[model samples]
Target: AAALEAYDGHERVWCGRDEERGLVALVGIHNTALGPALGGTRVWPHESFEAGMTDVLRLSRGMTYKAAVAGLPFGGGKAVIIADPKKDKTEALLEAYAEMLVALDGQYYTGEDVGLTLADADFIRERAPNISGTSKGGSGNPSPVTAEGVFLGLKAALAHKSGSDRLAGVLVAVQGLGSVGWSLCEKLHAEGAELVVADIDTDAVDRAANTFGARMADAGDILFVEADILAPCALGGLFSSDTIPQLKAGIIAGAANNQLARHEDARLLMERGILYAPDYVINAGGLMNVAAELAPGGYNREATMRKVTEIPRTLTAIFQKADAEKRPTNEVASDIAMARIADKRS
Candidate 1:
């Protein structure tokens, strides 16, 4: 499978299928030099098993780097369940999937990802202890945590570009009105940043417009909208070859993983004068939040939030390194993360 082709020193890959549950799940552990693999579970209507594995491979690898960059005491891994969350999700199916995760014996810790929610995580946690992000004694919701990190990274980007971190009067066009996007909009709105938001869900769009006073833009137009910052809180591969040239934002930073469709897209962003905040570097808040649950004493909300504040420093360092090296920010970020992983391995 093409997904299984991403074995660039990956630790392990496990494939599971259940005829009774009518489920196909793929789990990939990118690395565990730091600790046991920890990541979220994603459920999507993938076109084929290979496609789902491909997503898992890429996402798991991203998690490895994300955890490494965030300096967490965990490695990176991810799982994908082939099903449409809207229609195929059921208690029995989730429990079955949880059983699969439990079978890994804590090697893979899963929470929630796209098409999956904290509530769904609760379901999995109910079935097994190999899960996190439960409503009780766990990271309640990662969206807000992710939004906080993105906000701080955005400030860092603004400071680098304009010598000011203030968002007041800054225009930010946010794509996606999901949990993370909505929370990000709230943070930006509170700081007096003018918001232009887009989402395929009309209710989400209307809610943002009414609650945050954000202007509405069609999902197709959000990337091209004139703005100082473009926050992509939705899916990945948005800044691909076709869309990179259309991005008008001075700085590109958001919660999306692997925002570049291809690695070279980062260079294109640099060539276009768009300051790109390395996605994993800036969006490690959610990972940091869940990883805190495994700390010696327990999960400390204050400590977790405080640790999130360190994201800007990391972003600043990456920006400086990239600028000095005349390389893409993503490349610098990958190098930094890989070096950390390598250090642990050594």
Candidate 2:
């Protein structure tokens, strides 16, 4: 019931199922004040429809704030399919999900997310004609760009906390060695940051150790490792009351969406003197990159990156405001986004 009650004034919500094809998904459009909904589709093995519903609602809302904060001319939306991506994903199932997108009549555009890939985007685009992030005519992959944004945001966080954005000698504990996380580690390593990395995939961790000369931490211990920064490139909801007390890192910056388990966790982190870069704000480079496909002329990497570079400026402003008001960075960032959306609506 609490999951069903997790509504946050979403503009539209749709749940579709094709039992024969083993497809079950939920799409939540949180706002369209600026433009049509643009977000990626996540294929996760949620325990139930309610869990998927909760994830979709929260993720879609975060997308809205992400786009608004990034000054994108698109609204926020998200989709989640209730199945293990590795085991349950199929062309037929993706086609069925695309049909659901077609039914929405272009109000929502889908791309790639947690469990999906560029190939999956291409398949969905062929059937739905409203998808981005495909390898052919859209942004090929957004992970690298997203990592760049986080890299810049982390530098900004460093500057805000220590007065210099230099990464040399800084110890960053990166959790998750996925595409985005791996790319981020590369950037940080190039900047001379010492890395302590972890991932459930031992292979990834071992690779990082070899390539970046990173120290390896067990997946569960990475969060509490004594490092200058903790980058949670894995799943969301990692910063909660239970875990905040154990965080040894002074700064939290990462590409994961919904990092805070609850709104109050921001304050908890603040209380512990952890400077948190809002998850959506820092992870928006992928959305910005993919949404460029909808631009008048088409996707332009130069223009997209030009915009992505502004992520740090935005974070700096939010950090200054948070410091002035003694408020959580997430709260301040959300207010700024909400204000932008309200102004657009009016």
Candidate 1 C-alpha lDDT tens digits along 223-277 = 9999999999888878887998888899998998778877778999999989999
Q: Write down the lDDT that model 2 would get.
A: 0.93
Error of 2 at 256 (Å): 0.1
Error of 2 at 160 (Å): 0.8
Q: What is the lDDT of residue 120 in candidate 1?
A: 92
Candidate 1 lDDT score relative to the true structure = 0.88
Itemize residue pairs with steric clashes in candidate 2. none
Deviating ranges (above 4 Å) for candidate 2: none
Give the range where candidate 1 is weakest over 10 consecutive residues by summed lDDT. 1-10
Encode model 2's per-residue lDDT on 54-137: one tens digit a residue: 999999998999999998899999999999999999888998999999999999988888999888888888888889888987
* Local distance difference test values of all predictions, in order: 0.88, 0.93
Q: What TM-score would every model get versus the actual structure?
A: 0.97, 0.98
